[model samples]
Target: MVTSGRTRAVKLDSIAAGAVDLAREAAEETAGVLGVGEYLGAYAEAERVVSHHFACPHPGYRGWHWSVTLVRASRARVATVDEVVLLPGDDALTAQEWVPWADRVEPGDVGPGMLMPSPDNDPRLEPGYTGGESAADPEPAEASVIRAVVSELGLGRERVLTVEGRDEAAERWLAGPGGPDNQLSKAAPATCITCGFFVRLRGGLGREFGVCANAYSPSDAQVVSIDHGCGAHSSVPEPERAKELPPPVWDTIAWDETGGLFD
Candidate 1:
């Protein structure tokens, strides 16, 4: 406990002072009996209650303060202890409340007897059509134009890809490696838009992004921006193969053993 030289004095009423003294005595007695050490010099008084703080003497228990609160009745000269409690100091080692393992589980924390439930309103999922039992059944007559567009584009029956979805995909691709400022795109001769293997996507997205079908290209089978390109452009000609050399002729002449050559 520390007090500054310029500390303001708290003018406590006589009743409050008596309560504080009673709280200190009670705290001392409790600490002596429990062998928990003695109370500090500093004490707190509020209304009719006074708190006397004690130091925790137990090993491995640091930054813990024990306190005894004493309260006085109306017009009463004497005060009685309300309760004794252990509280955390400015720097205390405290443990969080005990939680069952089940309550502490995260997304990937899987184990036996653990049940994870899907949320009712997940953004990735849409409610199934309740008109027919079979999923293969054709859509009802009241289906909207958006549903027709989805079916025509082979997008899927459950959810229709909207303009917003296309914009989001374009934004992601523009910010990724396929963007105009990327190293591969900057050094290329021509953009994917001019490449013969560039397959334009369906709908509005085709204007900005397309699939590269050039097997030799780095972006093959992958979505690329209109202005993005690699070294393997479709217009680049293949190098010619070198011609093979003719086989060498062999001599059939025989040599005589007398140091003279015989043909």
Candidate 2:
């Protein structure tokens, strides 16, 4: 038993060291490859992830660039290094060396409008945007649109709005525009088109925001973000939570008649 315990401790130590090593390597790589502007942009994206995950005041980093390293050196012998170059302000590390937004959406931000399938870029995003959008796609229209899609198609018996509102929103959009007449081709085209929400619920893609089971990948709708309950916002939601997401700003996308989603 004691021998086993020592072995475990040794393994743990290796993993911890590996994590540090991975972070350091990524930081170096980031510094080497990116210019100031590019690094700042990457940092901004990383900051969002960090802020959302930590939910604390910025802790500050030693340099403008930072990276996340995950090393499983013992059992699986796996090592992962994520490089993130931050701008000149705000640090996001905890005393425990944790960056909360590492895997979550930034606390109070929307999607980033980037393309997908390039290099960890979210595939679900439309071709117009630049960076990977955030993971949360909360919108009021999501509820109605998703419901309409599902009701129209008669796909699964799953009910919308059980626990979290996100699920319902996702389901409804997956159903598509026709309500029930148009059969969802291979994947939910209209609903699955957006990338941020895709990662929020469905798993990540090996190449882009690959195949989502969500009904229709709806095109990006314009969602407004005005101060609710403010003087000029009387036209906003009565219940506050029921406010619709700003309509998508991009042009309306046509229904995919070709059958395949990405096609």
**Top lDDT hit:** 1
| Tens-digit per-residue lDDT, 195-249, candidate 1 | 9999988777888988989888878888998999999988777889898965647
What is the Cα-based TM-score of model 1?
0.50
Q: How many backbone overlaps does candidate 2 show?
A: 42
C-alpha lDDT of residue 160 in model 1: 43
Model 1 worst lDDT run, 10 consecutive residues: 127-136
Index of the highest-TM-score prediction: 1
Error of 1 at 212 (Å): 2.9
**Alpha-carbon RMSD to native, per candidate:** 8.9, 29.8
Residue pairs with clashing backbones, model 1: none
Tens digits of lDDT, candidate 2, 202-262? 2221112223222333322321111001111212235546767776787476464575777
TM agreement with the true structure for every prediction:
0.50, 0.17
